[model samples]
Target: MEFDASHSSSSLGARVVLIPLEGKVIRYAFKLEFQNTNNTAEYEALLLGLVEVKKLHIKMLKVKGDAELIVKQVRGLFAIKNERLRHYRNHVWDKIEAFNSFSIEAVLREFNSKADSLVVYAALLVPHPDFTTNTYRVELVYRLSIPDNFESWQVLENDK
Candidate 1:
């Protein structure tokens, strides 16, 4: 599926992207935070996208965004300078490399406004969950319990 997101940066306007990841669409959500710059937020979106997509166990992905600086940085065309962004950038790189293959492309603002709006809306949403890792809507509603001592050996012996 191709997921597009755009984040409003208040002082700097908004940033957005489209990401394609193969999966069951079991989960979907976004997070907004205080950051040093808009570029960082854009990269953070991609990083978060990859991390969450990985949790879905998908093998391929394509990331699209309107932030040219972020796409360039991720593609190695630009050097990351901010100390905080450096860590976030590295984290995103690690997530991207974990996949068998991934790509990032720069999109025009005209094409990414909706996603950019999502970013801003997410940032301002109230009554939001507090967890750092995103979750599926189904996962959030279901409750599962497992016994403390249900070992495989026990199951094998029970078969007899």
Candidate 2:
């Protein structure tokens, strides 16, 4: 799995691209509805990627991302100072526990272009009524808009 995050003035977006050992590529894009820092968005992207891997019942997995902070934190080389990050870190650990073997590495952005493009695409997406679909294997974009105080955001799914 590869992950990336994009941030704008008013919103954040995350994307995860999964390439199974069988060589099938699947992409997931998300627009975060809440206010979050760049690090938070990175963590969110990592967590979302883990969730996707877990759903596949994969016993062993390797994750890659361009976020050095998140990679270091997950490897225990950096400390999580922010309270929100601590929560996200815990969630990441929990999801990772589901896998029998898991490892995450930080790679340069140039090497992670697929995930990077997914994030950029998510950030630029505008919701429209004409988009509606529920196909799992195709490229999926989730446009989520929520209030700053909202506890949960609804995912609007579209196929691309």
Candidate 3:
């Protein structure tokens, strides 16, 4: 798995790419409405990646990121000084404990390009008016109440 984050003046973007040993790839992107530093954004991406792994019932994982500080801290080689960083570290630990085995490594940004591109894509996403329809129409937006429950949302054509 690889993760990355990008920040703009108005928003923060985070993304993670998971590649299993079987060679399948999964990607996630998120846009944060709040302001955050680059390091904080990296932490958010890491946390989001871990959550996705847990949801997939992955027992072991090797995580790679370009953030040296986060990689070292997660590996217990560096100390977290900032209070906010400490909190993020604690959350990372909590999620890691659920895994049977977990390892993290810092890699050059060049090798982490997929995750980097995802972050850039997320950063560029902007909400705009839906011009496809000339008539204004009310559409029901449905969301699953339970997070990470993809199976619950599957619909058969007949049911729809």
Candidate 4:
């Protein structure tokens, strides 16, 4: 899964792209209807992707995001001092347990361009009626080589 978040004057949006082993690609872009911070929006995108992946009974998952702090927190490296973020982290952990294997890494924005583009579009566009149908459906919606137990900050090993 590749996730990204964007905020406009009045809305927060998230986008996720899921590519399964079967080679089918699914994409999701949704506007957050509630008040949220960028961190929360990032988590929302991840949570949404996890939910859909669980529904599909995917056994393994690789999560990629441009949010460094959130990725580190989920990896148990950073201390989550905020209660809200702690809660989000707990939720992420809960979802992660359903998978046989999981790995998450922080990625540069340019590498996550598709989801990033969807986030900007979601934040700014007035969607057509068909968009809602496209947004929530199960039919909708990369690899970073950072080691699972790495101790320090690691740069992305591959860009494409």
Question: Candidate 3: where is the Cα deviation over 4 Å?
Answer: 126-160
> 21-112 in candidate 4: lDDT tens per residue?
78657777776666677887788888888877888888989999999999999999999898668777877897898889999999999999
Models sorted by lDDT, best on top: 4, 3, 2, 1
lDDT of 3 by residue, 13-77 (tens): 78888888895577777775565788878988898788778889999999999999999988889
Q: Candidate 1 vs candidate 3: which has greater TM-score?
A: 3
Residue clash pairs of candidate 2: none
Candidate 2 has an lDDT of 0.73
Q: What lDDT score belongs to each candidate, Candidate 1 first?
A: 0.52, 0.73, 0.74, 0.75
What lDDT is reached at residue 73 by model 1? Answer: 80
- How high is each candidate's TM-score? 0.60, 0.77, 0.77, 0.78
Residue by residue across 25-70, what tens digits does model 2's lDDT show?
Answer: 7777777766678988888788777777878788898999999988
Give Cα distance to truth, residue 27, candidate 1, Å: 8.2
State the weakest 10-residue window (summed lDDT) of model 4. 138-147
Better of 1 and 4 by lDDT: 4
Model 1, C-alpha of 75: deviation from truth (Å): 0.4
Stretches of candidate 2 off by over 4 Å are 126-160
Instruction: Give per-model CA RMSD.
Output: 12.6, 8.4, 11.9, 11.1
